[model samples]
Target: MTNTTQTGFALDEADRETFRRQGFLTFKVLEEEEMTRAWRTERLALMDRSNAVYTEEWAVSGNTNISNYDRHLDNDFLADLITDRRITDRVASVLGPDVLCWRTEFFPKYPGDEGTDWHQADTFANASGKPQILWPQNSDFGGTLTVWTAFTEATVDNGCLQFIPGSYTSMNYDETKVMEYRPDGINRNRKEGGVRRGFFGYDYRELQIDPDFVPDESQAVPIVLRPGEAVMFWSTLMHASYPHSGKTEDMRLGFAGRYVPTSVHVYPDTDVVEEYGGKVSLDRYGAVVVSGENRYDHNRIATRTTTGHPFRAH
Candidate 1:
């Protein structure tokens, strides 16, 4: 494994080759004890979202997916986590030197919760009907690099992430297609393999380019992780999760920080994010540059958290 003085865990050429072939990589980014302590405090503190960047009345619709969107913009701990060198350095190794963290979200699966539907995100327009991120016309890639950290121990019984290796090269679903968000539809659908799954409230199958195309579950691999461990993968990879079997009372939580090159335009032609039965204004939204300098002037950049904590880039 090759390591750089600046980036202690930078991916070696072989590592990059593996990621290119498999479309995902797993690594340890945070200490278990530190993450446990920090999450214990931060989870309670996050309850008071009085200073959150997305504070519109509709943004707080209870239990909606939008409720936990972009907390890194206000929470100091999350801000530091997103810009952590361990993550950004590896992300930069794959996506190039200049990288921006455009989004962060909390994925919590309580006992008895359904698994996320098998899906791939390119432009991220499946449910919102608007392209959330737009790559340059000549670019070869189309999706963000999502670094998903397990804030809580993730087991197959508790909805651990599942992925189809080497499934990132081509998109099976069309992002341009619209998916109806029916809040009442949660936990109601089972796919071909009888895996109880749904994408929040929307059925990801609605966006499938070939409605008859069912994901090959035989090739799916479950990723069980200890708390503080993380896996970074292309957003276009075929990924899902196992349903929480109600075997454990503790909820499984995954924190995802999404990164893209500076050349990409985040939230292109929009000031609001509408999805999952709620809408939020982007008035206070800005992409945080986590590595290298951003030479593009297209996206709004945030140098500090809403609470005045500066983001320290690698």
Candidate 2:
């Protein structure tokens, strides 16, 4: 595992203790024409959300459930793939050298959709109830370090990302427990083992502090990416996915990119993020250091990229 590689890609020494006891990590950062030119400039920047930093929420006025969260502060190939250094130098080698790529979303399952539920997120507050990230009152635990990536070929029939390995220090769903946004309960519940997950319409087992727990899917796994591949996990980890199975007509499309460690607190007293039912307004949000130097001025950073692209830190 101490098999190394450098000049911009990292993690060796037994893959950094196997990513500090398996929070997660996959490879191949991007190729295949940089995932077909970042999915053709993210489908022409999602049909012009007019410089989107998340204007309309559930994406298309159609509701495939909704996520265009930060769009890397208005896309410059997702702001240089969210400060790429093979993902901010392997998440600044597990969060240290001043990292900070505060959010960037866009999941998109499609075809028959539904899958993403298991959930974990340390203070993402499950989904915007508050505390989008705090970490460091002497730090016992903090989460964000996502990265996701595969904007196209994921495949376990179309959904992909599953995880569970070491279960990242276990929180078992309870980001201060909230969960209840039912945009008509998205693909209609369906999970007493029939599978077809759901979180976009919120049912992450209803904030499961333990309402009959359950998620030992034989220690899950399936991450299968290909078009530009990428993984890096631990948004608290346990994760979930796998329901697309419309037998394929191309849809998977992940693209996360969270990160943290500029001494945390990206959205402390948040300004309007709500959740799947839709809301959004951290009012021109910022946070994009991406590697070092941001020695704590609390938050709101953003150096260059409302469309200019100079996030360059790593």
Best candidate (score: lDDT): 1
Q: Per-residue CA lDDT of candidate 2, range 1-314, in tens?
A: 32335535667767778777888978876886868876876787666666655566445344443456776676677787887777787778878788888877788888887788888888887766778788989997888889888878887888888888788887877777777777676777577467788877777788888789888888787989888878898888888888787886777888888888888887776666766666666666677887888878778787773434334222
Clashes of each: 0, 1
lDDT of 1: 0.88
Q: Each candidate's lDDT (Cα)? A: 0.88, 0.76
Each model's TM-score, in the order given?
A: 0.95, 0.31
Model 2 misplacement above 4 A: 1-9, 16-49, 53-70, 73-81, 86-116, 119-163, 166-182, 186-197, 202-214, 217-231, 234-255, 258-314
**Candidate 2 worst ten-residue window by lDDT:** 305-314
Sum up the clashes in candidate 2: 1
State, as a TM-score between 0 and 1, how close model 1 is to the true structure. 0.95
